[model samples]
Target: MNHTIIISKRISIYIIGLFLLSLGATFSILAGIGVSPVTSLPYALALTTPLSVGITTVLANFVFIILQAIILKEIRWKNFFIQLIISFLFGFFMDFTIWLTNGLPEATSLVLIIVYLAISLILVALALLLYFTANLPTMPYDSLTYVIANTWKIPFSKAKITSDMLNVVLSLVICLLFIQSFGAIGIGTFIAAYGIGKMVGVLLHKLQPSLKQWVYKNN
Candidate 1:
């Protein structure tokens, strides 16, 4: 394939991934799942800062990229720019979805929450699907785990487990601070998040080949 053509194709897949990520985020929030690591930054900021969640997300990701650059020193233009664009896109869609769902009737609210959970779980699967479609850098969180493992000469699986545990603990802390002390977080949020992420990773791997091609060609 022509190099330019390949680049274009990858960008298209990334756009699709961005939409899926944004919708997944909406589902996560509505399902009351523990907030995603990156998303948690915005949630925390929302407590004290007057900024919107979407803006806060972009700001946090920018800071994260800077930190990664300083620490790893392998920050490439394509990967950094692509991640930034996708984060911005996801944030936009997330805000839209939240607005669309916030006004549901009582029964509708319950039904929507169930739908949110189901979609949130599947979104993780879709994420893996979308990830392989681009055949590019994994998400930033995964990339960090890889670097940490490689630098420390540890097994990738071990690194992944530790990273995930860190997120889990961090989520718990956020829940404690917000729902327990500050009184903002809710029940079932962290549990749903942790469970759905694991379930999705397992389920997605089984269907990776087909999902990868579909997300690549169809999207």
Candidate 2:
């Protein structure tokens, strides 16, 4: 049987990973502790301005893309199309997930909140790993990591962890000075800043072999 519609295996994995990433981010915010360091600045802007988290995320990603060009000293528009696509999809999925999970009750206890945080960390880490396995162009935030890593001749994980910490610090300043509140810098944020890095390291060790077999680009 010849099918009119076909999808690649890696694209399927990417979509699944994207949805999980959105759901994970939603749960993180709903936990009321904090957002992940990667998203903390966007969350702060969302709280301080009329823009939703999705809008802020989109905008922030665009900025990151620009930063990538600046750092690399060139613009490869053809190669960057996937990054642009993923950026828009990330925002859309995040907002859609927030609305879809609107019925979840607010966490009132520390235990429940911690559970949500744990789930958020794992989902995010897994989502990223899947993205790697898919072998697609990464989101700008991650692309920036590669830019930094290659530029400095350092490991990707080290670059990413350091970037996460720096982003958290920048977000904290934005929250206190402009947002006039703590924004999203709770204990969970700190945990995610460091913990997610460790989790991703451990997960990647197991994921590399599987990832070698998957190639995401469309033929």
lDDT of each: 0.62, 0.82
In lDDT terms, which candidate is top? 2
- As a TM-score, model 1 comes out at 0.71
Q: Tens digits of per-residue lDDT for model 2 on 62-171?
A: 88889889989999897577788888899999899889989887889988898888989999888877766776678889889899999989998899887788878878
**Worst lDDT 10-window in candidate 1:** 181-190
Query: Candidate 1 — which residues are off by over 4 angstroms?
Result: 1-9, 73-78, 105-112, 167-194, 212-219
Candidate 2 regions with alpha-carbon error over 4 angstroms: 1-7, 205-219
Across 91-210, the per-residue lDDT of candidate 1 in tens digits comes to 676677677767743324667667766776577557656655677766566666777788889999788677655654554565466555422234434554466567667756777666
